[model samples]
Target: MKKNIKWLLLVSLSFVACNNDDETVAETPVTAGSANFSKYVALGDSFAAGYSDGALFKKGQDNAYPSVLALQFKQAGGGDFTTPYMEDNLGGFSSGGNQVPQFPRRSYFNGAAPATVSGTSATVLGSHVSGTASYNNMGVPGARSYHLLAPGYGNPSGLVTSPPTANPYFVRFASSNSTSILADALTQQPTFFSLWIGGNDVLGYATSGGDDSSPITPATGVPGVGFDGSYNALVAQLSTGGRKGVVANLPYINTLPFFTTVGYNPATLDATQAGQLNAGYAPYNAGLVNAKNAGFITEAERVRRTINFVAGKNAVVMVDEYLTNLAGAGLPSYRQTTVDDFIVLVSQGVSAKAHLTAGNGTAVPLQDRWVVSKDEVALLKTATDSYNITIEAAATANGLAFVNAKAIMDQLVNGGIRFGNYHMSATYVTGGAFSLDGIHPSARGYALIANKFLEAINAKYGSTLRPVDLGNYQIQYPASL
Candidate 1:
């Protein structure tokens, strides 16, 4: 009986031990997976550089996506990350005793509207950083993908001269006059890298209201190659020698608060006001019918272009080159803007409230940079799609983690994403995402971005870096900073 009791106790102990082994999640330690984070390097454009509120500053650098990512990477065997920080907490840089070309410092919402502080950066720089080896972050604001491969891109001497010009921000920390950004990263022979280029490629065009003067493709073509040769070249160099990295694709520019702040219907009117507005557009409606009957335009276009203002949130008239110009017959390029049309953020306070609705107003039609028309928006969409295709292909071919910037932007615009215990959206202020510029993301937004890259990295490289809590980061830095 004693022997049987002892055997029963031993069996019970063995069963409990087996259950504990299976249930304990804390037993396995998170690792950097197959990739090495000891020498991580980042390269790209403004987004990579931590540009925010129309400017780059010290705190912005601290909250950079790469900087935030490196924090997690550090716990998982990542090396110390570095950034080309501004001289002070006050945003903006002074060169040759004059402020830079942008609006002084950065713009910030004063709780009422976006406004810049009274002055600019008073601090002056003495010289650029000497050693190239110590540099980790090579993100240059306003740099296109091609610029990263372009030699002498950081040369201050070439800024006023020929083919290869210098970026002012790069001038502060560039190691040499002849080294390319890619070359500098190569010098480190980084085991890991993160590339978030290509936004500036379309950003200039988007902000300029579909101005084709700004090309998305490289200006200088490499013959016998496919589309986005520069991008492909960049990928090839970074992926060479089996280096692992993460790259982000372009997002649809229209989804940004820079374009989405103003709505299709902001013009609310009383019954009398609505009637007056309708009478004013009567000529436009009659012209549409006459043009359609004459076969100058389709009946669909006639309907599409006809102006109809309701008592609330009405669409405004604007010029459309597609319409037959009948200026001599009293009809011009004017037509009502469709829902597909996007009013720019600059038009937010001034758009529907000030123009086209008032009787005494010229009704000259909102034009140029005031809005991004349907045709323009469609063009941007096509270019974005094409770029993403190339980006995805490169990532798959090279075995690099791909970050879908488009998806992130879409989620932020449509609904909020969970970060920590809080919900974060892309809305300008309270959204805790975008900065006052309406173009760039705030510090918290960058944290979310870092987590996205980390997720892709963990999936592809098997890295187990934990994501940072978004609520820990600031929504927007004080304008004073």
Candidate 2:
């Protein structure tokens, strides 16, 4: 009986030891925060390129957030990062087709002489050119999230179309057929990544006056992609071994200078012009009034007119037309009078009307038509809400950290953030944050954005990345001004 008891006890001990081994084999140990991000990869659209003042020039590219962020990362013990850069010096539109001149570059302050065009070359720049651990920054301007997976993405000489075919930045670092933006990034097996996409997804529509809804197919809605599928795919690929990363959400373009610069003032109207406007000769003015009373204050106040040529129809309110008409009618004798003089006169209203001198005097009829209205504000808010919903949903499902860029933009417009000791607003020309096109940001503005990203990173990953110094960036002004 004692021998049998000993044998039973030995078998039980053996079974317990085997069970422990099985448990240990099934459960793999994970290293927390081991994904140190020695290799940094940035992916996004025009904002990623540091496009400012309606153009992508060398100056803006050099001061781009990715480059700035790379500098910060290197100082923080991260590996050196690389970017696919353009060779073009003159940073605006370039001529491609026959006889059609490229869009002229204008000063963000005053429309001055057109900027020179720069040429682009087909070449890559970085430490490693043909391997998994290759280029770091692949932030292609004007690229959609879906475009990352397309096969012929890096063709520089392809037929240029909407969202243009040849992105010189992408063409520079493009590898063999086996390598792609998404595939290459994945192969590198990055420990850390930064993605700021979905801006261009709605940007094209907004810039085209909502006239071009071409991007909205059956597959995607207004905000498009809902991006759930792509988000899931990316998470599956990148988070396979629990890799971590940060993602940025879209901001409301309406909050930018592009939409806010053109406003109108009904009280500044002259008696004769007011009569015409009241009679509906200026239908846009009427819309602005309706929009204002309805609570629209900015770009959302502009009515959308199907006809491009007709005035006062469905279109955004433009203060220029009324000012032009007033100047032509009120001061016929003055030669070579400019819009600046008119703006000055209109801004002062009736208080400075007596200071008018025929030729040199700045006084003229006050016409307020360039400002935004209340209805337009509502429209912008609606668009912003829709976009944020899509962005938040994607981030949540994918376990990616998202920055509320729209809220940041609103803060900038509402005078909540101070950059370089200057309060930033959406006002054109005078606003320190935005460039001349009233759409894109200045170098200082991009710095503010970089700080926002850093804040989000800290929140999501418990990182202590330092904020960018806005003072280091330069703010260029037109020499003519």
Which is the leading candidate under TM-score?
1
Model 1 is weakest, by summed lDDT over 10 consecutive residues, at 218-227
lDDT of 2 by residue, 318-396 (tens): 3232222223222221111222212121121221123222211212322222222233334445655665575577567
Over 313-388, each residue of candidate 1 has an lDDT whose tens digit, in order, gives 6677666665667676577777767688876765323433345455312245676556678888877788788878
For model 2, what is the alpha-carbon lDDT of residue 112? 46
**Each candidate's clash count:** 0, 30
The TM-score values for the models, in the order shown, are 0.85, 0.64
Q: Which RMSD values do the candidates have, in order? A: 6.0, 16.8
Per-residue lDDT, model 1, residue 307, is: 76
